[model samples]
Target: MNILFVHGNYPAQFVHLAKALAADGHRVVFLTGRKDPEVWPLTGVEVRRFELHREVSSEIHPYLIPMEQAVLQGQAVLRVLDVLAQEGFQPRLTFAHGGNGLSLFIRHLFPETRLIAYMEWWFRDETSHWCFPSYEFDQRLRTTMRNSIILQELEQCDVAVTPTSWQQQQFPKHYKDKIKVIFDGVDTSFFCPTPVKGELILNGLKCVQPLHIGENSLLLTYATRGMETLRGFPEFMRMLPPLLEALPNLEVVIAGDDRCVYSQAPDRADGSWKQALLEELGNRLDLGRVHFTGSLMYGEYQQMLNRSDLHVYFTRSYVTSWGLFQAAACGASLMVNRDPATNYVLKGDQAYWVDLDDPQHLVDCATKVLKSAPERRKNIKQSYLKSEWALGNCIASWVELINAQLKV
Candidate 1:
């Protein structure tokens, strides 16, 4: 089958799926923004750059910025699709990330093409408007207008795939029947426990160690883009002081790029709310004990997970993080913030649940897992490995779903 994958970044969610489909001899081509020219070299996938006039702006209203960016990018995508059509390049199926407007135009251009959108999230109740508080006054009024536009695009798709049932449930009642849940697979082979592994010697402290019987060192890790308030960053920071006071041996690692995504420029002031959090933590920051390894490479990330005694994943909403799945695959016992969306992915004894609103609960839940008996920890880790959450199995299932849909 000839497949055209569309996203702002090539192969973002379709990383493994694109490779899998290419290996099976399907023709895979990607249309993405003008960054990272060599993203998928070995997948036998071809990339077409979509050039847009404007960069994503942070000064304008946050809501308007992404919308304007998407429309501009969509125009670029349409131009590329037009060239492809002129060259007689027609795909049997089209897969796109729904947030972008490219798919809507693609459906109009190629009415016969079967379209499937990977629905990451949709704004429903007031809870979905967490990004900006000021936007709340006009959020529902704006969201209703935006939802109409969004639904028009989504309704054109033949099918919709979501990473979790929680995300699928976010769609309107009419679209719920069309949504299918498939995980964004993790690389289990790379994430598993490695014996005799030396501690991650970061900033002079040997914090990470392999699981050795009777070893009581507690390693806790939290990773993401940065310390964004909506991502529970402020709460994590608020909880840190109390946690540090309670557990002396506990070593915490915060990983990710410190730079704010929506910041105007690189040299801008660093006195954001996130920076203030770091300042307040002050002497208790424990440079040697609490490491901040900013934005690690994939291999280093896996190693960090492998070395963790417990992984704490906190999010204000239902958006699932690939890092959490990777940590679970690495056999690190996970303590996740409780949400309806998270409950769909993590279940039974697979993870310890915590309330997102309660900072003390986050610390307590993580501490409980950290202080658990070695045998109990080992059992939870092993159970996580065997669960449906494994990356390899998840990838296989995604391939099967795509293949079945394309066959129709």
Candidate 2:
């Protein structure tokens, strides 16, 4: 069987599924805008690189800019598609990650092949997105326009899938039935707890040199791809000073780059939220015990998770962060923001939750958990194995879903 995949970033969410297909003796062709193949080279999958030869005009209206970018991306992908079509290549299935317009014209060429869209999220309303406010009419209009491409793809595709129930619920009521919740499974065995915990090593961030956490040191972890307000970086930072003052033995290990993706820059010269927060809480924070390691390798991350006395995470209502789930898998006790998404996985005594509005409450919760929550580590692991969200189980379901679509 010939299977085609369309993603701007190759193997973003398709890592496990693509490898599974290739191992099953299927020819997997991937179309991506990723320039460097060495970064992630799947053994059997053939990756085709597409170049965006044109750019969206600066003069274009703000609301139309997103669609313009998608159209340009779609045109670049179309060029690649045209070549494949001429070469007598007809895939049995085309799996596309929606949001980008790359796969917008895919079905036009391969009319017989079934198209399946990987639905991440749709900006259903202002409340659904953490950054937007419902009262902001202009921003809401722009967001509604942004969803046009995704809606088109969703309407046309044979199947559409979102990673979580929360994300699935974010779509329109009419389209809710069309979207299925298929989580991007977590590898429990790989992320499971490590028994050895003696020393902590941080690869080092550009802004902060890492501090050492000895054998007896109590470690607190915060991991994310970027230090953004949407994920509660600022609120988390505010809790750090007071939490450190309370516990002298506590050592902090922060994992992630000092970049913002979902939120605006801080009101500072450098615009780094990390730098701004540090400046804001300057002498109050004990620099000796706090460590900031930009982006950790998997081995380092796993070790930190295992060693973490309390792993603090803060994500908005609809957004899903894999780091939290990994922390859960590693039996890391969580101190997270109070949101339905986090509450979904970490409930009851599994995690220590606090609202972003009250930094003092976060400090209070962390202090209590650090002093007493020894058994809470195991509590989260039990519920979160989401046995259904386990890699093997979900992969099997993916195979079944893909094969089922092929038959239709």
Candidate 3:
């Protein structure tokens, strides 16, 4: 069987499942626009690349810019498909990400192939957006227009899959029947809590000497891909002043880049939200206790999680970060902002929840979690993810879905 995986980035959501399918004796080909294909270490799978042939027109309306870019990307994907078709490689099934316009033309080219879309998000009117101005005509117009490619994929694909129930809920009610909620599983084994072999060394990027984990020091970790509004960094930052002031021994390790990957840019002319917060909170923020390690490597990240006395993961009504699960896997006590309705990583008594409107509540929760007993801090070992969102189980689920789709 020939299986194809398509995404803008290489080995993203399909990282674990792609390798699993390849090991199952199926020929797996991953088509991506990732700049560096060799960065990923995939043994059995083949990686292919495509580049956009044309640039988006500057003359077009700003609202249509995304749609235009996606159309060009669809053209690029079609060209690659034509070459693959020439090589007599007709994929039995194609798993393509729905966000990018890459999957737009797959159904048109391969009529018989089962094109399953991995729909991460479905943009609608501004009401669907969390922080964006819902009443503004332009924001609402752009929001509705952003779903052009996604709606196309939803209309064309055999089945669409979302990682979380929240993500699935974002789509239109009429198309709800066609969507499936399948979590992109986590590798619990690597992320699990085991004693770090030696001293935890956070490789210093800004500082001269590497920061080693102190035995007596307490770590309150806030880990994310980017320190943006999407992951509730500002709220986390606001809590820090009061938190560090209250707990003298506690040190907050913020692990991520200071860039806007998901959310809109800051209103500040400098365009950095972190900087904006620093200016806003001026002397209130405790600079000494706050450690900003700009994007720790995977090993350092896991070690940070392991050393965390309490992990803080706060976000708006958006997709939950993978760090949330990693923190859980590492057995660190959680301080989540969102409710149980969206955040399935931690349940009742397993973690702490705080309100978005109440800044003091966030500080209060952090202070309490840090003050709690060490034994009481760690939670939810191999039970939850092991049964549900573990890598093996999710792979099995993908196989089951594929088998059902292909009918043996």
lDDT for model 1? 0.70
Off by over 4 Å in 1: 54-68, 201-217, 259-273, 365-380, 383-387
The deviation in Å at residue 32 for candidate 3 is: 1.0
* Every candidate's lDDT: 0.70, 0.81, 0.79
Which candidate has the top score in lDDT? Answer: 2
Q: What is the lDDT of residue 149 in candidate 1?
A: 45
lDDT of 1 by residue, 1-408 (tens): 788888887667878877777888988888887488584564588888788866876686654654666677677888899998998888888888887676767866778888888888787655555655455556666555556546756888888888877777777888887888887776767777654254564431122543221235567778877566556676776766666667777777777766543212222277355566777788776655566666666766776676677777777664767777777667666777776646666566778887888767777776677666345544434425445656777887777776787688
lDDT of 2 by residue, 293-335 (tens): 7777788788888778888888877568888878887767787
List where candidate 3 sits over 4 angstroms from the true fold.
124-127, 131-135, 196-199, 204-208, 340-343, 373-386
Model 3: lDDT equals 0.79
- TM-score for every candidate vs. truth? 0.84, 0.93, 0.92
Model 3 lDDT per residue over 254-275, tens place: 8887888777777778678889
Q: Between the candidate structures 1 and 3, which one is better when assessed by TM-score?
A: 3
Greater-lDDT candidate between 1 and 2 = 2
**Location of the lowest summed lDDT over 10 successive residues in candidate 2:** 376-385
**How many steric clashes between backbone atoms does each model show?**
0, 0, 0
